[model samples]
Target: MNQFKNGDKAYVIYRNPHTQNVATIQEAIITESPENNEELSLFLMDTHYPLQDDYAIYTTYEEAVKMYNYYFEDNEQSEM
Candidate 1:
């Protein structure tokens, strides 16, 4: 499993179940991650506070980085 300590950046994509459209994508620092679990409890960067909602959890740090770029960098590239 990819280990992320506090302050490491992480991301999650929220999609609408009915429409299957992206509701929102959140990027945050790794505040807390339970042992042996896929969930990463976090402080939402948007609010800088813990979020009780769905958040992204990657098994590998590389996967997290790729997804972060997939949502952030890809959009930035398009906008330029």
Candidate 2:
């Protein structure tokens, strides 16, 4: 089942492996999947990301930030 509809606003936490920078929150738009009608995709950074478990999509910026802090910031602090 599709959790999002076309044109819906969404948020995602992006972490660049090449740069190894802190995770940043990015805003995206839910769009109809070009490959499948039953699924939805995220239009982010001029790219299409399929709405799958591989990418965690949030409904709000706060939610995305909270998850980012939990996974990234907290881990970094704990390592110190």
Give Cα distance to truth, residue 56, candidate 1, Å: 3.4
lDDT of 1 by residue, 29-70 (tens): 665545433454565544443444445565455777687678
Judge candidate 2 at residue 58 and give its lDDT. Answer: 90
**Which lDDT values do the candidates have, in the order given?**
0.58, 0.84
Each candidate's TM vs. the true structure? 0.37, 0.83
Which ranges in model 1 have alpha carbons more than 4 Å from their true place?
16-20, 32-40, 45-55, 58-80
Q: How many residue pairs in model 2 have overlapping backbones?
A: 0
Clashes of 1: 0
For model 2 the TM-score comes to: 0.83
Candidate 2 regions exceeding 4 Å error are none
Q: Of the candidates shown, which would achieve the greatest lDDT relative to the real structure?
A: 2
Q: What is the lDDT of candidate 2?
A: 0.84
Residue pairs whose backbone atoms clash in candidate 1: none
Q: What tens digits encode model 2's per-residue C-alpha lDDT throughout 2-56?
A: 5678999999888886887656888999987788877788999998878887787
Model 2, position 21, has a per-residue lDDT of: 68
